[model samples]
Structures are given as structure tokens and as C-alpha cells.
Target: MSDFNSSVNLTMTINGVPRVIACNPADMLCDVLRSAGYTEVKKGCDTGNCGVCTVWLDGVPVPSCSVFAGRAEGREITTVRGVEKEATEFAQFLVAQGADQCGYCTPGFTMMVLALKRELKSPTETEIRHYLSGNLCRCSGYEGHLRAIIKYLEASHE
Candidate 1:
């Protein structure tokens, strides 16, 4: 019912700054954001199985690769870069726990962890595991990630 070749202009608040980007109606938000210079939104399993392209759509984390770009019009989208300060602090914990290897999954993992912190406040280990189940890591075996999350959460509450 719509022209596939046509580009649509979408205005989204990215990292607290309003940006207008042109993308095809069928373009995925991950592709659009990356093209618009938000490379922090990585592209992994474009089918949404992998959480590599997670971004906060209006303060809720969702897989950008599974979302249509046009759906983000006039909405606020927060990538990992949007929470640089908190992410940086959390990254320290990640490194100390040896969870920052490869880094391909770090951005999305960070977004999910940050969301967990905000939403859960003080989550149990099982809750943390459940919350992060969508994110998969090929390296580190996730033990390091779990340690890093526990450490980060402990530090945050102090």
C-alpha cells in the first residue's frame, strides 16, 4: 500500500537531542540510527533474538533491529551513549570482573543492565539473570558478567 522507494522523515529525540532523519518506511530503527551516526546501536541478530541492537524507546529498552524506523517518529530513543556517565561507571565494574571482552555485546548488555538498575532497584541474582536472558554473549561464559553486575549493583547502592 506504500511506496518502498520513498523516504520518510522521522523526528526522534536521540540522546536528549532532537534529530530529524530520513529513512525508508521499511527501514529498521537499528539501521536508521546507525546511518544517522548512532553506531552504538549495533546490529546482531536482526531477527530480534539477539539483544545487540537494544535501545530505550521512550525509556523502555527494546530491540531496535526489530522495530520499524517510522515507529520512532516523535519519540525519544536512548542509545548506550545516552547514558554515558552511568555506562562508564558500569564499564569499570565490567572490566574489573573481566566481562568486557570482545565488546560486541557490551553496548546492549550495558543498556539492559542499566535498565535493570532503574527498574529493579535491588534485584536478586535470579532476577538479574532473568532480566538479562535476552542478551547472549559468545565469550566470557556469563559468569564474569554476573559478577560484574553484582559488583556494580552493590556499588550503586552505596
Candidate 2:
């Protein structure tokens, strides 16, 4: 009989849908997601240290770079591109507030913002900063980001 330890195809839920993709055991979630067309889940450091690779796995935000495709089997992965309602609000807010210059880090920031909005329907300025502490922005100071977040919360209330 075979050892049966070899890697096999893994299936997982991405953005509230099911996806069964063939991948090696060594393949990371980021790679699988990208290949499956969820390119929004970026690969920043690939070390799990940077929050850039963050994704909500069953409602808990985690680093996709550190996760294996098999590990994500049967789990719900929410990428920025998959969920656009909240994300669009964030993007619109960023543009209106002049926060997304260069736009390299907006995806990551948007993910964190989604998490914050889930937890706090309306977050204060300090709360926004505290929640977004994990995501790193290479350009544009936090002033615009803060403005965007605050404005989004305000709009949600109205």
C-alpha cells in the first residue's frame, strides 16, 4: 500500500463561494489565490510579517503568505476584489479624501478597513488608527487615510 502522504487537490471557499483547485502541498495560499484569479490577495513580504497579505479566513484576518493552500481547504477566504461593496466605499472615500496616492497599499488598507467596519459599525479616529496599525502604507501620510475612514463611517450612519 502507498504511504498516502502525498499532497492532493484541495478545495476552499473564497469570497463566500467554493473553489477546488489542484495545487502542491508546498503552494502558498497567496499563490493559489492568485492563480485562481483572486489577485487582490497580494504577496508583500511572503513572510507573514507584513499585513499586506492579509485576508479574512472565516472572518478572522490572517496572512495569506503564511497559509498553505491545503490549509485553506474548506475555509472562506475574502479578498479585497471579491467583496466590493465595503471595499468600493473605502476606495471612493480614499479618492475623495486624497488618501490613495500611488495606490500600492490601498488593497491592504481596504482589507483592514473592512475588518474594522465589521467590528465597529462606526469607528472613531483613534480607533481607525489603532485598527489600521498592522497595515503599512509606503506613500501618502495617514491624514488622508484618516479622513477617508472617518468619512466612510459618517456615510454609513446616514
* Per-candidate alpha-carbon RMSD to the true structure: 0.9, 2.5
For model 1, how does the per-residue alpha-carbon lDDT over 1-158 read when each residue is reduced to its tens digit?
Answer: 89988998888899999999988958999999999999988988899987999999999999999999989999999999999999999999999988888999889989999999999978999999999999998887999999999999999999
Worst lDDT 10-window in candidate 1: 20-29
Q: Candidate 2 lDDT, tens digit per residue, 1-158?
A: 43234656787888778878877756788887888788777777788766788888888787888887777877788888777887887799889988878876777678888888778866667878888887877787789889888888788778
Model 2, C-alpha of 153: deviation from truth (Å) = 1.0
Query: Judged by lDDT against the true structure, how good is candidate 2?
Result: 0.79
Candidate maximizing TM-score: 1
Off by over 4 Å in 1: none
Report the lDDT of model 2 for residue 15.
Answer: 78
**Superposition TM-score, candidate 2 onto the true structure:** 0.88
| TM-scores for candidates 1 onward, in order | 0.97, 0.88
